[model samples]
Target: MTTSEQLHLPAGSTGRGNYETIIDPGAREGWVHTGLRVLALAPGGSEVVTANGVEAMVVPLNGACDVAVGGEDHHLRGREDVFASATDVLYVPVGSQLTISSKDGGRFALATAVATGSHPVALIRAEDVPVEIRGGGNMTRKVRNFGTVGAFDQMDSLIACEVITPGGNWSSYPAHKHDETVDDGDHQESELEEIYYYEIQDGPSGPGFGFHQTTSSGEDKPIDVLSEVRTGDTVLVPHGWHGPCAAAPGHDMYYLNVMAGPDPVRAWNITDHPDQTWVRGTWESAGIDPRLEGEAR
Candidate 1:
């Protein structure tokens, strides 16, 4: 058993009123900015979202849908599954009516932040999603930037992205932390709470599984989480060094990351662990794994 299974929320464990799965900052004591909601709809089903003080990003986890926001319908051509390809997304600013409907049944994930910043609504297409191949060798993985910082900078605090690690590979490598708030106009990590929502690809035998690790960074913010994550499972990072998630030999892994913080500047600042920082240097010589090139296409 991994240390501190307290942070691991298995599938169907966090359901609340109206949503099948919901995680809200206001609902959790001491958590201030981030929120996530998973909504499932039957064919021809519809619902209005009441995210009054929050800016939200609608990501379709499976199947297609139409997002009605700002008096317009933003049709999303969602993928068959998370492992297929990057899906379309919609951004809704605060104080707006957000409604979603699908002719065919599917599930959607709403990544949100408690914010008041003003930004126009955007209908981001799937082809426009930036695909990044990061790390090298077995540490290699593909990152899809949908609501990430530089990719889509309309919101105030929300920063979200998708990562796909091939079978038998590792990602979020060389353990890193972004738990300290520093403002000297120089180097310092920003404090942010992160959410990792996982979806593992199935193998020939059965449903897939993987291992996740997040330990303390010795910065007084203690955390210890070693979880065997599966589809629809989630892990919360309040503060710690998180990295080196391992996908089982026959299973590929996909995780959507939702992040937000108290900082005014919308930036992702992180500090790699001193001991494993050296792993980055090796990437200079190590080429990317060939399997990712085909899958990312």
Candidate 2:
């Protein structure tokens, strides 16, 4: 059994023993179905990333880039940073060759998954994304549903999105899980493996950090993870109820969620923890947190 300490991947630890950090599907034991890679380049830098057996997306974290996929070129109007604005995205099907180049180089995230079907290359613009404000009170947060199940449904197995939690706020709350295939009338839960890639916004003086936890949902498969995550850190959730990602005071928190599973139907059906189910009912009275404004509205 892998310990929680093992699941907490610090920046540069999984750099494929080089200058680049790449977390392939099989990097961690029992984690053999999802992929994420962070690429950093200098000015006028370019790299060719091959999606030999998986479906992938080229997302610019900071600065613009040109992505050449399947004989077509797609230019992404990227943002200054994750905290600045929502950026454009490019999707590449399995067995495709992708060339990512930037005139003024920056960081990029290559999110991939074990593709179940082949789809055409598509470019998802930043302006076209549906920005949503989910939860309320201190639970308020911004969610960019760029590639999730209901927002943009074109992929075969992968589901991806970005979230921003204001300073001192809590998001991904009430603990939830989707680790079982259940069909109860209209309600259904899909068994999925998830990854949390974090980027804590720096304060005026120094760096920042946040806390995350994942516990078993009283199931046969035992799992536990509690970590203090910083920028470039990642946590893997094989099967458990994850929640309450807390952003420390004076520093906002940002994360990119990548998910995929064995279900034939692509969906994100989750079951919240029974004890915390009452939290949802109190949002109406508590009202939404005021700090969540501007970009998401």
Candidate 3:
């Protein structure tokens, strides 16, 4: 009998009835190979997915849709949220037979995993997303690799992306960790399984919140979460040692990282927290956060 309800999963509590929020892998107990769903349609809503063995990725957490499968017809144009900018994506393969429409509705973000192999079905637009801007002062953040691992490389075991932390920033700090598949030789990590879907921007006191942390880089994976996230929150990192994810002072943060596991390759090795790993070498002289300046793509 395991417990802790599998880390924090607030905000409307995973629309258990269906879309609007749905974490897969049966939603807990060391959640397997990643999963997520956050449909939220309305004006002329539509849905008809059947992602049998997983391998999805239709991110657009804000609006616009129309993603038929097989015979093709993808078209997303989403934006006006997730900090607006870098939208459009669609890559449904593995068991197929999907369909989605949204004449005026919004909120999408499906991002699954599990398929052993099979990568094709593409789309990825938004000026070819790939705007990395990692830490610096205030621990800057603003990554949007689109379907990660060298920015989109046709997928299999999904590993999506989306992050933007401003407003008193401090995202995923020195408290790193990737679960560990190997690399105990010096420090390299693997073994994914992560998911954090959030969005919180509304300062002047209408509604907003931020702050997420994961602990237990010991006791053989026993985790301890500290959450306060809002705007459709959902944090689940099967193993521990997460990070800052702050963004509060005025509120302006966003998340959308959905990782995978059973790693054979699809890299992304992490491993900080060894006494704070020297604070990541002071971020090359700390000096970045200007609201991520000019939004470089």
- Give the per-residue lDDT of model 1 (tens digit) for 18-102: 4667888777765778888988889999989977888899999999999888778899999899988999999999777888999
Using TM-score as the measure, the top candidate is 2
Ranking by lDDT: 1, 2, 3
Alpha-carbon TM-score of each model against the true structure: 0.95, 0.96, 0.34
- Rank candidates by TM-score, best first: 2, 1, 3
Model 1 scores worst on lDDT over the 10 consecutive residues at 1-10
Q: For residues 104-221, could you state the per-residue lDDT of candidate 2 as single tens digits?
A: 9989999888885899998999999889888888888899988998887888888999999999988888889988889989878989888899999999889999998888876577
- Candidate 2 wrong stretches, greater than 4 Å: 17-19, 294-297
Please list the C-alpha lDDT of all candidates, in the order they appear.
0.87, 0.86, 0.82
Residue runs of model 3 more than 4 Å from their true location after superposition: 1-42, 47-54, 57-93, 100-104, 117-171, 177-188, 191-198, 205-244, 252-254, 261-270, 273-297
Lowest-lDDT window of 10 residues in candidate 3? 1-10
lDDT-best of 1 and 3: 1
